[model samples]
Target: MKQAVVGYKVQNLLNFLVENPQLKDEVIGISEPLAATQTEFVMRRRRSLQDEDAITVYLLGMEGTVAPLPLVSQVLQWQAENIKAFVHSHFPGDADLCGIIGRASQCLPPLRKALNATQVDKDEVLSLFIDHIDALESAKVPYPSYYSELLEMVLEDGFTSEVLHSKLFQDAAISIKEWGSPRQQQTFVAICSICPTATARMLLRYCSYDDLSPYVFDYFDQRSVGSMIEPHTYLTIRRRLEKSLSRISSEINVVFITDSSNGAVAANASGAADATFFSVRPFNKPVTLDTLFVLDAATISSFHQLRGGGVSYPLLCAEARECNSRRAASNEKRKTLPQGAVV
Candidate 1:
């Protein structure tokens, strides 16, 4: 008898939510379930259902007030297929509710399985995955694994610039960066490399110093110097890097350069007369650029002296010369090689 009562109550609540559209919206939007009961729509519903039964009366009270996540979870439990159908029927042309339902029902594997088994459209599935990705955090799903897996799944059919700029993709990238998994890092690079122009545009708009720095480094690492060898690609990447470096803190003078061996380097300049060099490289390869280096405030002063045929900063000047000479030697070596010979 107790099992039957509980089951009836669950069904009653589900029916109530379905029948009362405004009340359902309020319930989903409300952060606290109890808060939703105070809303005008829910209060009106309570008055109408006042004399229905003990179960109906209790549900119309705080008993029926369920937070969005738990409510969707309950709904999913009662009828897995109904969740999607419920969205289409009750919340027609409503993106907000779609996102809410998607997010709330995401942690239920059975629902996802049912959706897949029934051959749901790929676009709908992608939207569902994006919405529910955060649900994993609360569900204690293995985050990094799921993150990469979902990314690969979404990109299986290829993605557009629009997809890259979506809140879902951008947020996922930020989360991946925070996780700092090497495998995921490479995945990030590969995704960005597919459409370098779009990636650059997105970085310029959405990415901060922390995000852009690592992406730039990782991109070169994965794609190697050969990928950006095109004049347009090189300029696009260079301009973006310059923008990022320019926005860094004034106190920390960083010199961005590509070495003779095609390695990208960022050296932090200290207060000393000669800027202390440090190597921060994404990969080791033959990275070359016409304008090979960006000297910050500290090194720029000495760089000016070197340009005027004076060697006020011997260390920095010598290093610059060494880099140029090595590059020239590499070019000359290539020239001496027979046609089609690998250097």
Candidate 2:
């Protein structure tokens, strides 16, 4: 009769043998929730049994998600004891497991030590896992029932790839390209890619010249060099536009602004400031003054007379500049009283 041989992808090797008699000399399993010491034991065991027969090999789980550290540790530890070798899987595309494995690798020194120990041997453990998974897939073994769910979790939570590719982000990018300046577009893209959705929104909503200047300034002071303006800066600029309009005009029935890219910045002014002036300052550029003008219901109605009813940034900039020039000339005229001499 063949010697009863039980193989496990992970050890506590003796425990597995004690639990199942049929698995005796035939049982093979892999480790789970891999840690440092366990991985060494596995590697060692496999090396010692290189010449052994009647040993079965087992590869547990799918590729990418395979627990490597403990498995490697176990193999290393058992090499001295002479255990047979078995293949293992690594689910590389699985983000959750990859993150877990990454974190584990960082936090556990023992695992790293074991991996370094094999440096002289030039064994590529990760490559081995990948090869094993490929071989298993080619062999047409049935996948586990939970495989899809595990993959989904990894994609959604472990990595941000799904969120970055989401429709919301794509739409925002498209809008920015269409209406925002190049700087604005780049800033928006960076925010969408790097920030959590809620945080990004908050940054846009709060950081502005009028509402939170001090806070915004402080934030910039602390950021990494060359980082783009935070969302809060955009929000502050929007609020400043709203407040400036309120102070300058009374006919402005409503005032609102949006990212043009994000379609998110929106506000309405009523009551005394029913008619309003709105302006947008593209990132890294001075505000366009020629475009500023009073907006009223009648003005909006007149705008509708044109092919497209939306307000135009270029038109607003022109009007704002003209208005400022007239104001400055008026101030000059007032100061002309001194030309007579002293009084």
Candidate 3:
């Protein structure tokens, strides 16, 4: 009768029989239950026999979140065997088994020390475990979802409390400083709900005195401006505005003058000259010879006729005369004042 290998098992068992020619005549009968429990049963059988030959036990897709080495040690103790080789299966996607095994080894220091293990013992155990995992991965074993969740929890909680807070503040300060400018700093501070402070000083570096004033004003707009004023406040705004205006006007010049033609007239015998004639149109009415300039009664009569309609000429002439008088007074006062003195 042909030897039977259990559970539609690998045909390699036939090759095994041929290699050990002495075993050819021995009937090979395999059981599904025995194959299923092979690792546990073999460990027990080996201990009972006190076998000299090393036995390999493969734990395929074992469950539970405890580190593998300690768990494997417990299982070996339950079978009352000093395990020659203990291996755990891996899935196809398990790429970092070396790192995982290194971490697992840390949890098994007692087991390693109890085993009186040398470097060679450690290496042999790791090699055996890795080879089993490699074979399982090649066979496309699936990893349990609980293992993934357990790994995520470990990673998430790994940071020390001190390191976590340090990183938090470091990232926050850097983010605030990179946002740019004093106005932006204030805006960001307001948004972040942070009080102004030296640690947050970068928020204020690009801010000018004037830049803060309006916000200060609006901040205390309900309160008096005097209460909001500081030594830096007024100077900063004044300097900023002066600098801004200087930059704007650097390429252009502006001059202002009043109509001199209507203001100057020959004095009469009574020391009262005839009403000075000034063109009455818009304030910016173009200065042209045809825009009838009236002096004395004759000019006034001609201006009335030229107007024909629209706005009273006598009223316009009176307003223009008042304007001219005020302008002359202002110029006389300016002449009296010292140059470069503030008005």
TM-score between model 3 and native: 0.14
Q: By summed lDDT, which 10 consecutive residues of candidate 1 come out lowest?
A: 57-66
The most accurate candidate by lDDT is 1
lDDT of 3 by residue, 1-343 (tens): 0111120121233224323435533423432222233223223322332322321111001101001122222222222111111122232134454345444445456433523454435456555444543443344233333322323222222212211111111112232333223443211111100111111121122121112212211111101111111323223322333343453332211100012223212211122221222211212222333222232211111122212312222333333333334445544654686864322
Candidate 1, 1-343: lDDT as tens digits: 3222222232333334434534644544332332222122222322342233211000000001101122212222222222333334334245654444444456657446645555666456545644465454345323333343333322321223221211212222343343334443211221222222222323323332234334323232113222322334343443444453344322211122222112211212211111221111111111122212332211111111112222222222232233334445645765797874433
**Worst 10-residue stretch by lDDT in candidate 2?**
59-68
Which residue pairs in candidate 1 have backbone atoms (N, alpha carbon, C) closer than 3 angstroms, thus clashing? 261-285, 261-286, 262-286, 262-287
Best by TM-score: 2
On lDDT, who's better, 1 or 2? 1
Candidate 3: which pairs clash?
277-294
Q: How much lDDT does each candidate structure score?
A: 0.29, 0.25, 0.25
Deviation in Å, model 1, residue 142 alpha carbon:
26
The TM-score of candidate 1 is 0.18
Residue 108, candidate 2: C-alpha displacement in angstroms: 2.6
Instruction: Please state the error at residue 148 of candidate 3 in Å.
Output: 65
In the range 1-343, model 2's lDDT, one tens digit per residue, is 0000111112133233323434433432231222122323333333333333321111111000111122212222222111111111223344554443334445455434534563522134344333433443344333332322323332233113221111111112223233223332111111211112222223222222121111111111102212112345334433443454444432212122221211111212212111121112111111112211112111111111112223222232233233334434534654685543211
RMSD versus native structure for model 3 = 50.6
